[model samples]
Target: MPFRKFLGWFKGFFGKKKIIRLGLYGPPNAGKTTLANKISMDWTGEPVGKVSEVPHETREVQKKEKVTVKVGGKTIVMNLLDMPGISTKIDFEEFLQYGFSAEDAKQRAKEATKGVIEAIKWLENVDTALVIMDSTRDPYTQVNITIIGNLEARNIPIIIVANKIDLPESNTKWIEEAFPQHPVINVSGLTGSNVNDLYSAIAKYSK
Candidate 1:
């Protein structure tokens, strides 16, 4: 009994799992919040953030911590970060199309610009990043390249998620071709399609 107890203690000491800070980053309405919500709800039985059709809906850095996720029978503790939508330029006029008043639109734009800066600053804190991309759109955007380039410079682990794969317009091939350096997981955050694959990839790649 004593020997077994000592062995168990040794294993427990050596087998301590590290909590990975996983950031979900993408452009406007690309489903970063949705994916973060899915992951958080799947593991924690709760959501991390709200989803909206409006651009810059998530105008802040949202975090959900101590989420225990199971992937391929392996349990992982994760701190999920849902970052704001990043764009090369944010115009208040764009919000006018969404029926927002000029003042409200301008305020949202200001907050969104700040959110982008915060997301970039938080890159230093990310252990691994899941760069979410809209599968239906062109993948060769300055935002996507900038996000990937920054992650590359920091030597951070990246898992690109081609979100909205359930949409008929989605072409995962384009995203794959655009980012050949990292593994891409196709998922639909809205429909919860192929989310298991995402979990498996997270477990496999996120160190």
Candidate 2:
């Protein structure tokens, strides 16, 4: 390789690319934490937050710092912010199905509402956002549209993750049609399918 090209590549490898806060935002049970865990584990040998079947399992914004990701021979440093699920309404009755007492459920509901606010406030600090959507669910919901609109209005770099592609009913194409202007990577966070594609997209577009 030529010396100049080598130097450029070396700079890309070692030179300071300002670290970015890459946030994950989506509705409840859309695999935000699952994807965060996958990426964090791959790079840092750790998971950012626990995953649960119950909705609003992650009732807080969880952050993992200094995670370095390499894609297509280029590396980028990021602080992964796994934001809590965004919902317009939170009712304690929803938690009853999870076997929580009425009091416990109410408390959880309160925290979850707070989490939604924190997630939105954290958006001001995020340089890029991964709008995660469940591929198996309809992508035209108010929550999904609202999040994307907020990010677009701010001109934030956005990548739509059509997660859970491993499921039989997962339809990534629907997401493409929903938001034709943005790039979407289809993957299964639970099974690790096509996650490398997501990494490459992050490297290519998030910069």
Candidate 3:
């Protein structure tokens, strides 16, 4: 069957809505872009955004459409927005490793500061947010808490994605325990693990 038809059938089987919106948000290098790429590929069969090892690779919000997902026996069309990661401080050290001269690094550092501010400003416009976090790192960063607190203050639904679950040092349980009130899902973007559950959770609350 055609992929769209298959998606439609799948959606019909699940009883999901016809349209949904999701915003992917997280700190730098926490797999926000990775998860976004995975979801875009799974639903549309193509990548909608760029993936990079460097922090702040996505400086702007990249959106991809034609996402056909099944929830509660119905097909729902999703418009996924992949946003730039947030950080309290710019990483000039990593920027220098990208082969940029000291002058260029300094310039980019300033640009990164603007980018972080832009990302925080953009959060207010999103309907729902998926806060991605690296499972191997501590989730106690100020940026993480600020994003969560702002989202909660605005009453926007949120899903905390603990990515890189396949990594040996991943500690998703700790994240869940730390943010007991927020919904948390363990996933591996590289291996496409536990993605369906994440999608399902987002779909459930979004509707």
Candidate 4:
């Protein structure tokens, strides 16, 4: 293993009070950053990254360290990792709809591709993963399957987040049915609905 990866493993395995490396992972525009920002701002008084209508707006992993969350007299200190949105493919043409120039579109596609690789690599470093899914969209996608498979293969704890429950078309039940084995929390990161339930889940399940 690389020195950095080894160090991460060492700390997670042996450190006292082990600051859980909580990773936020999901498909593009699935509200990963929005939830991350909500968590960070609630605990650290800071936001993780910018929210955007554009896919891959968070083209890099954002970290907030030493965030202390307390629930029911129990406290969990963690390093929150806000990961880039994962996608099966990146097409430059997709950016054109957002009014991007040809050159910028291609550049964004390249960066998004790289971001996917980086997010996958960071999987090895995460202790717990929150798989955020857009409650308004179908949950049975290759991207979601791939992410869950990778995390499960590594024996990492998984919490399925049914985000955007505030939307009229949102069907959090569909997501719960899709991944019944994992714990699912319905939340609307944008409106902060049921977010307390998310925090309680994080406190309960994060390792």
Off by over 4 Å in 2: 1-14
**Per-residue C-alpha lDDT of model 4 across residues 1-207, encoded as one tens digit per residue:** 979557767886785466889999999999999999999988989998999999999998999999999887878899999999998889999999999999999999999999999999999989899999999999999999999999999989999999998899999889989999999999999988999998899888876
lDDT of 3 by residue, 1-207 (tens): 979558857886897544556788888889887888898888788887788887777887788975887766756678888888888778677688988788877777777777777778877877778999999999988888999999999888889999999999999998998799988989998899998888788777763
For model 4, state the Cα shift of residue 188 in Å: 0.6
TM-score of 2: 0.92
TM-scores of the candidates are 0.92, 0.92, 0.86, 0.92
- Write one digit per residue (lDDT tens) for candidate 1, span 54-83: 999998999999898887889988899999
Model 1 lowest lDDT segment of ten: 4-13
Q: With candidate 2 superimposed using the best TM-score fit, by how many Å does residue 186's alpha carbon deviate from the native? A: 0.2
RMSD of each: 5.6, 5.3, 6.8, 3.4
List ranges where model 4 is wrong by over 4 Å: 1-15
Off by over 4 Å in 3: 1-18, 91-93
Taken over the whole model, the C-alpha lDDT of each candidate is 0.92, 0.92, 0.83, 0.92
Worst 10 residues of 2 by lDDT: 4-13
lDDT of 4: 0.92
Q: Candidate 4's error at 29, in angstroms?
A: 0.4
Candidate 4 collision pairs:
none
TM-score of 4: 0.92
